[model samples]
Target chain A: MNILAQLPVIPIILPLVTAPLAMLMPSEKMGGRAPFVFATFVVWAVFAACAGLLHSVATTGPISYHLGDWAPPIGIEYRIDLANALVLTLVSGIAALVFPFSYESIRSEIDRRQISYFYAALLICMTGLLGVTITGDAFNVFVFLEISSLSTYALVAMGADKDRRALTASFNYLVMGTIGATFFVIGLGLLYQATGTLNMADLKIQLAGDKNRMVEAGFAFIVVGMGLKAAMFPMHLWMPNAYAYAPSAVSAFIAATSTKVAVYVIIRFIYTVIGADFSFAPAAFAWLIAPLAIAGMFFASGVAIFQDDVKRMLAYSSVGQIGYMLFGVSFGTEPGLAASLVHLFNHGLMKGALFMAAACVMLRVGSHNCSAYAGLARRMPFTAGAFIVSGLSLIGVPLTVGFISKWQLLAAAFDSGRAWAGFLIVASSFLAVIYVGRVIELMVLKPAPADAPEIKEAPLSMLVPMLILVAANVYFGLHTELTVDLSERAAHALMGAGR
Target chain B: MDILNFFAERYNYWIFITLMMMGLYIVISRGNLIKKLIGLNVFQTSVFIYYISIGKIAGGTAPIYVAGDMESRAHGGGHGAENGGGHSAPGADGADALPGKDALGAGALHADDMPHGDFELAGNDLATLTGNAQGAHAPALHAAPDAGAPIAGAPDSSGANDILAAPALKIEEHAIAAADAVKEVAHQAGDVVYSNPLPHVLILTAIVVGIATTAVGLALVVRIREAYGTIEEDELESADNVAEFGAARAQEAVA
Candidate 1:
């Protein structure tokens, strides 16, 4: 009974346990069907646990479980406060919904040999993400980060069977990702040596009077390292190719979770690890992160406008979305943190649905290019409807999750005494509308190719997940109390930690 | 002299600074990805050295384990040696004395006995002995009293000593106390100092991510190679553009 008190470990452990079990399943006939079902169940269980854990944390303060019963400052601990628990729920919930959709999607897109391995990699990636969100120990975060990253690479590589360019895209990602992870580790190592303790809470207590120059150097390394991972503007070179060329399932999953997790880590570092009072405050943040974020928002959107491939365009749009998140965090205020968290959740839903819709299109039309989607609304009405709704959310239309996030971020920027930041946010939304509108126009108004093959609606399995996310976009848009309140609490905790 | 003082005063800082610059240079200048990672490592390691150096106490040993094993044995050995020496010292002092010396003569012959009245006068002549004995006990008593009196008088006599020693003792004690306090603070602060572990962790993850990304990239490159028959980036771009051009031309033909 006492051992069972550690239920929080289940979210990460379930997926890890299932990943190997997936590989061990016998015969392709059984292996193919069984792993996907098993993975779906495991992901659901994780989502359920994460939701319960999030509720528990919100009601009863943070939950901290030390692995091996070894107290903190020695052994690793999994700490789920309001902020991360909420993120954990968001990520795991998305996975739960996405996995069922993946079954039908994977059947058509991926080969037989890769299906079991695909589920295994997906599970491993889930474990990494869950581990990242739950662990209180700083180094544990890194370890889990690698676990997720390695699996993500394998998943991205799976796309090569479809498009040969997936190989080049994966390779480019590998190069950039290695640099980012290396930078992250160096920063963590420096912090460890400086403080002699890897426990975050203990480190916080110890760092109060530490005004050394080395600490400042560590701060710089961490920000840059995480910035690269989160795909903040100039460091986002690897994102477009990786997202565009990967398999539809891989693209949807990575698009929804990978950069969001990176953003979580960055927020954890900036607000919790290095208290906001540190000398590298407003000036450094404004000077470094803000310009790049603004640049990314405008430039990526502009670039996205020219992409012939729908998936690639969305990939570039993702870069621009990341820019908004960075912009929110750059404000360095409670409202700003709240805005970032909101956008983090909102963007996940929007991108997940958008990518899933693209997968549906690919399933029917055999390509994700804009030309292929011409008159798609007539042939595949539901998939096209899903696309339009998700696209509207991406453009921050009212009564959608995207609008909630953008509204909060604009309000945050205004609250931070930068009223013009609101204008910039709106302008970026306008840019998004332009890119997204172009695709909508091509899908609804343009004539289908005279020689085009007859297109059928995507299978129910794929549409279920896409619709769920689109529904969530609308549901959360109108009733944002749960998401917004959770974000607010997270913001408070972050602000308190920063001080 | 300037160079000597500079080295003597800030040698640790100099070492860290040099290493930091070297690491930074490697990270920035190198073209190969792995080499850049190694450079990142060197830069981070230098920061580690800096933090560790600052936390060191001037005379303290590294926090290693040794005292637990030796403590009991050393205590037992010290007790045995002290007891043996206390008993044997009396005999050794007497054996090394001149021949014919009695216990009283031996007692008087010791180096520490001069402060008390002399006992050798009793052995010389009866008349001198009687005269010396009359005041000898008195002098012995008075000698003990004088020694006792100085104990009380010592405080007054060393008033000037107290004045001289007071500030120095205070200074030394304060310095030691401050060092100890700083050490405690540093020990606690040790956990929180931003060591930039992120960079180290990020580097490894980035390497794996890089490799994975590279594999994916190469796989894409291979696909591009198959589609266009070249691994070159420029060629792939041209081919993709050509494909787009073909698609546009096909649209034109239909129109």
Candidate 2:
């Protein structure tokens, strides 16, 4: 029971504590492997904790632990409500699965000298993500947000050995990320000025009077700041390059966690901190947020259609996926919040599977371009199978996790008296099919190039992680009670608070 | 002609109409994203100013606590009695009794007084005890101007019972009348518009948003420079065009 109570902080702090320990390892050859193994075990522990936290939150309601026993409104609190607990589980589980594969993958892609530092940075990045999800304090969220972001920049920049452009991508991400963090800070400052509180629960009580201008300003700042981080539409320019240019392992880790964490933060602010009633009824924030979501879906997907690189296309797909999550939120209802939460989990699985498969292909073919993947089904059937299954989920095929989210989102839009929004949600699924279909066709149907060398299945280390995520995509798709029920409860909490 | 004259007589409408138009124009015409942000700031600020202006009493400050003050008295004056009582009692008679009284005192009195005492006392006895009930139930009886003269001029009379009733009734009527007069004066003294916090909130949010956006824009510019060796948007476009041309030429050469 005591260990369970301490689980939320452990998920974030373990990686941070291990980062320096990873650096203290004897040498890159023998001792370097120690960090990779240790990180893998730590990530597994975090995954277990996330699962326990999720179960606890779903059954027993929100789990809030004050840091150092200082209660909220004064002390920083770590809150594992249903919404964030579910995301925490997804993120930690993916990192756990991905790190084992990173051992072999890193050996091939990154230099031997960089391996120890890479593991150190990877652990720190994990800490940032889990911390961002678990903390209840608004400013604490920013601190974790920057920690994760700075590590991500370092991880992305480490790709300079393979492609010099990775430096530029990392630099761009750094700038955009800094701006996003600054915006977040300014928003928090405004909220603090208006309400004189940093704890989300306390801020809610302080902001109920509708007489504070500073608080309202704070809400806008927080939303836009988070939107930029989540790659919301026009704000998403940094993502594709960053995702495409980074090393395959780095790309997979980030694709699975970073933006999804950002989306979680946005949802946390909209539903838990700001309350849905303000977003939906009186202010009509849905009217503002929905259009941007819809625009991102079509605009990013359309731009993705022309990309030659499969990774870049999936990167654009991430922007569109973020749009779906945003669309669910814009409904500002229980079903809407549920859809967003479920999609947050589903998209992570689909993207993790897809990017890992891309990494596998990159490992074999040494390129992520569509031309390089020609007739990969004939050569590497397992990787191709993983891609197809995850791709179907991405396209929201019936009986998949994506379908469940889209269906709920459509229902939410209709419930909100905006049936057109439902139509748009359905229409955007077709755009997904178009982009996902392009990659599948090239990988499965097209004949292999004559000059191309013979390719084999991705090694057990890589294939196992891809298969696990793909399997999760299907498992969650069929038995969605856990994900959907928790999301519904979270949405209820949000809507009830607003009213 | 009459409608136009009525509108012309109300100068507040004219100012509202003019400020609203100017606010709309600034939001529309700005070029720089930051300037547009500022325009948005002004546009939202004007709306806040308007809402505050509309809600203003003749004397009111921003609804913020002043330093060195134990309590905030910003939202005082008009509608004071109703607000002072913390919106519990719905009847106008209760509101009238506490007209123009400081909210803290009246709030405590109403919270303690009405719910316990009013239900305990019945019909005519309740009406006679609380002057508000007598004034409200029989406005015409209380309105008799001669009632005041008897209270001031006569010590003994055939209508001594009526005379005793007169002073209580007159005082209740005067308080109600005073409340109405303050309300009328507040309506006329609409120049001191109550500060609407909504626009200030919106503007502050916009400024933060603007700074964030500028940072993002500058970041994108730096990224473009690094990627294409130029910060200019047009140069980046040309660089992309050239990259596309090179790729197409390579494909043609392979064919």
Candidate 3:
């Protein structure tokens, strides 16, 4: 047995082990920062493992690791094709970058006694996401999804130290997330009954030419369930408060990775398992995903512009950004799917940077409200600069990662002869410009209060991660080989698997 | 057939659907967090029942195997060579046999054949045969020849007789003998056909996942109540609204 072939499961195992270890760390008067140190090291190891797995997959094609040497169709398999490899890299890489930043981000927000538990929950959440991306079994997806979601609820509730509203936000999210997971399992049950198999590859083979009502019902359930998790359109009611009220580190990590993983699952279910030939009818695409995608773009952006809280504004903007991804998927073409994949990676970078910047500002100002941001540039120049760059990226300004994805998205929109969608995409970016510009205007243009206290920039631990992610947005924006190549391969693999 | 008859045959499905609707309704319509969690349990349990029903094969026993070819196993030393020579390709020979047939004990059964009603008869016959073999070795085993002796009456009987009687009538021993006989037949027939253990295993996993979700959910609810002092959805929503309005006014004052 080549041990290198087993590298796919290490990303999951590293964090799974790290979480409980972090929990076991004594937080009061004993282990000052041991939990943070342990968690950061493990997250970095997960990132390395994911990077190695992605490289192996890109070179050797898909890697199949039978857990305990059990073969597929009988045993659980962890299959990593290009699509999941890209997501695994994105999720673990973001977790690695965010954990270092979280030490400083949580120091003020969470109590000293609860800090270790917070780190424990964060690592478990990371493990859940990695597990979801790596597992090839349908039921395994549900299991991992709950693993991540349950921990995320706990992590969100930790924000109660800073704001009690975080409690309700976490509760609402728990309820909705549970419902979404149950629906997904119900769909998995239907498919298992119909196909006598739970493995995605086996389902693909068994479900070929079998388009009964039960299969169609399963398709509906899976899409709706994943859509709720992805926060697609009307199902996104729980997101704004949860993101706004959660601790800034949890916000940055979850905003950057969780929904992206859900979208990846939706794409996998539709293109890989259901087969785009059956599920991707023009009428269905136009009638279902098209309206929801467009509605989420405009409605969310519209709601965002009116928000006073900076974090909540960004949360609504996150919903609008998800719209662009779903819009790309609605085209049901290679370019469209590729554009969605590109945005999935690119938006993760941009939003991670933005939320980290927000965390830095919150460190100084004690609030994430727009009014608290007046003349912030004079006090925290480095963080203000990071936010400006990422904010511009959110607006799709040229030479930023957002521009790259939006350009691809628009090109695909027009390539598919959806001129109206192209126009709408451009229009939504302008809405992004307004919301982003509002922040820049408040931070740079407004004058400070007369009795304003002198506040230094965020600590170096936080600054380093924020700058690194901001640098990635600019670097990948200019040299798009790695992201574009990976996304294109993943998109082609997905489309080729369909039908 | 009328609709009632159709539903009667699939009463489990009808019950699943009804329980699913009730659970979904409770989850959506209830305001209390704990009630909603109970609703979630009801919903998830319905799915479990649905999956278990999918794995339920009519007239099928538990997925565990019972001996199907006692004659071949009893005379296995000769039968293996005879069948291996006769069916050069074992898979094809197994596929050719009739499913659910009682030709198993005569050494004519194949691996693909679904064990049916005759499987129990075959097990009893093997149990008796094994019993007789033991009786031959130890004539003292014939102390209590009552095959179905009441266990309550055993205490009044001779101690040795009670031991012999209980062992002969033990269900587990019968099952073990049957399984042994089935394994021997499986070796002769080239494979074992089972009642789709995969779904049962997968659903067992799903049920565990469901319980984990419920535990986490209830934990969150407990925490939410501790912090907010209320776990009712309406109360929580109103509190959130009040907080939102206060923040808005504060922002306006700063402006």
Candidate 4:
């Protein structure tokens, strides 16, 4: 096979191989800053590989690489269509930025000895997420999902150095995540029993338009399971604490990528393997998941307005953001799915930037609460500046990436004759404004308390990546070729491929 | 009749439901961290049983057919395989067949001439089938070398008989006979109908994941113990509530 043929598995394998080596770089006799450099190199390589994969998928349509030439329908296949290619690029692209940002950002947040190990864990987590996105095998998705979830539990608990609350948060997540994963496995087993195949493409062919009870039960199981992982409302209990307690760099990376990938899996299972034609699926999406999406938007954003802790507030806001993505899914039309995919990409850019800004604040002020942020705009000007730009994006202000998502989502809603849902989206934007406005008011309008800690602007390491993401928010907002057009194409590909 | 068959033949589903619910009940009802993990293990084990049982065919043998077994059974007029006598697919068909048994007898794999491996063991497994059948098996039992036997009791394996009770071993011959008696059934002269191997293979991968989950869960509990000094969920709750809000608010929240 040529090098390009082997490109799909590299994003998964390269980081998995290099992460351990990076972790081992800090031995007592041979210690240096090499581990950080190596980990950064590894993430960027993965990012480049994903870019190549995306290019290949765009040019050639979908690329399916069977593991070791084992052939599809029997062996595991790494399917790189437009849909997963977009998600792969988003995840690795976030990891690429977050790695260098974390070098300086996590210094005050975690123990010194745990730094290299933390980077390694981050690499493994990235690999797992990438693996989940690329595989066409249903059970392989579970395998990679667990790989990521297991590491995430450890990464979130690493916050225990800062607060014991992180421990409880991690344990709570472990219990819930395990139950969620097992539910997913049960669903997979049922699918395997019905079709006698684990490959997603094969399952689609075998399950073509047959709305039997076994498939229906499996569909329900798969949704609820992935719902918990994607931080779908009511099942999103693990998310806020996990994000709030994690190291700031980790909070940024995970917020930007992990739940987004879970959202991708939900889309994959529903539209691809299960197909929208299933008797129960469209009805369920309209009745169960869509209403939950509307409820989460109101409930979480309203709750975000009351939170004293900025990190927890942002985490709640993330739940509300996911509601927008799922709301797009509820429409069940091509434009609707396209709108969902667009938000998935745009949300990654915006949320990732927002969290990195919070990280810069955490680096200096050493507090997660909004009170710590009182009128530091003059002192940490760049940090507050980046925060304002990203915060505006979060509020769906014009000429930022957030507007693109809300515009398309609203358009899709109205196009599908769900004009009330469009109104709900607008109303939710107001809730985002209230919550985001509270923080903006703190950073901009309010005066600094006289006793504010004598703080400087964020370090170059943090500011550089945070600014790059913020710039991308403006860049892609102006240029819809990448986010809007590509996502719609991805949507068309997914819809065509599914049926 | 269909309903009765549905209930009776599908006892595995009933047992799966029972074990699954029991594990879930334990996880939900327990407050102790370790007990919750134990419940999770039970829950995971039920899934494992469900998957592995799904691989079982009611009348089929294990999916473990040796390439060597097929080769030996190929040389019908010959003594045993050049690779040494291995247990076979059906039995050696002609001159090497069993005494007083039909040369075409399906499961009666006469191993009187075998030099190595589990042909004797395969026959002795049928000792439970009929007491009178196996004095002929006595000399072969001692000669059944453990070396080169890939699967020790493999030849006796019906996928159903493997996980089933010891008494199901006796039904292997009858199952094979009853299977052959049906007109719709088809087989080669030597091919053993194997249960689907894919589910078992899938379960093996799943078991690895289950172990990892258990290990990670326990490790998280260890960290939790170090942090909170307790693994009880309620105690950790009160401790977290106190840590989050002030003592007064934590008390009110608890109430």
Question: Per model, how much of the real contact set is kept?
Answer: 0.23, 0.00, 0.43, 0.38
Candidate 2 lDDT tens digits, A1-499: 5776686688877888988887666447683688788778888887887888888888888888878765565557998887788889888988988899787777777777878788888888899899999998887887778778877877887676776566557755765665566567657756654554567886776666445455667777787888888889889988998999888888998998889999888877776677665533335455667788889988998888889989999999999889988888776677777788888888998899999999998898888888888899998999999999999999889877878888878888888898898888888888888888988898888999988887778899898888988889899899988888888887777667666
Which is better, 2 or 4, measured by DockQ? 4
lDDT of candidate 1 at residue A95, scale 0 to 100: 96
Q: What DockQ number belongs to candidate 2?
A: 0.02
User: lDDT for every model?
Assistant: 0.71, 0.68, 0.79, 0.78
> What are the candidates' interface root-mean-square deviations?
17.3, 15.4, 9.9, 8.0
Error of 3 at B155 (Å): 35
Model 3 lDDT tens row, B1-255: 698898897898899999999999998999999999899889988988887776554333344322333334344333324333222222223433534434433333223222221222234333333332222211111111223321122122132222222211222333444655544333332222233445566678878877877887788788778877898987776666667677666455445
The window of 10 residues in a row where model 4 chain A has the poorest summed lDDT is A25-34
B-chain TM-score for every candidate: 0.31, 0.31, 0.50, 0.55
Candidate 4 structure quality by residue, lDDT tens digits, A288-372: 9899999999999999999999999999999999999999998888899999998999999989998998999888888878987
List-wise, what DockQ does each model earn? 0.10, 0.02, 0.21, 0.22
Candidate 1 local distance difference test against the native: 0.71
List model 4 lDDT by residue over B101-121, tens digit each: 334233333333221111111
TM-score for the first chain in candidate 2 comes to 0.97
Please give the lDDT score at residue B63 for candidate 2. 25
The residue-level lDDT of candidate 1 at A21 comes to 91
The Cα error of candidate 4 at residue A435, in Å, is 0.6
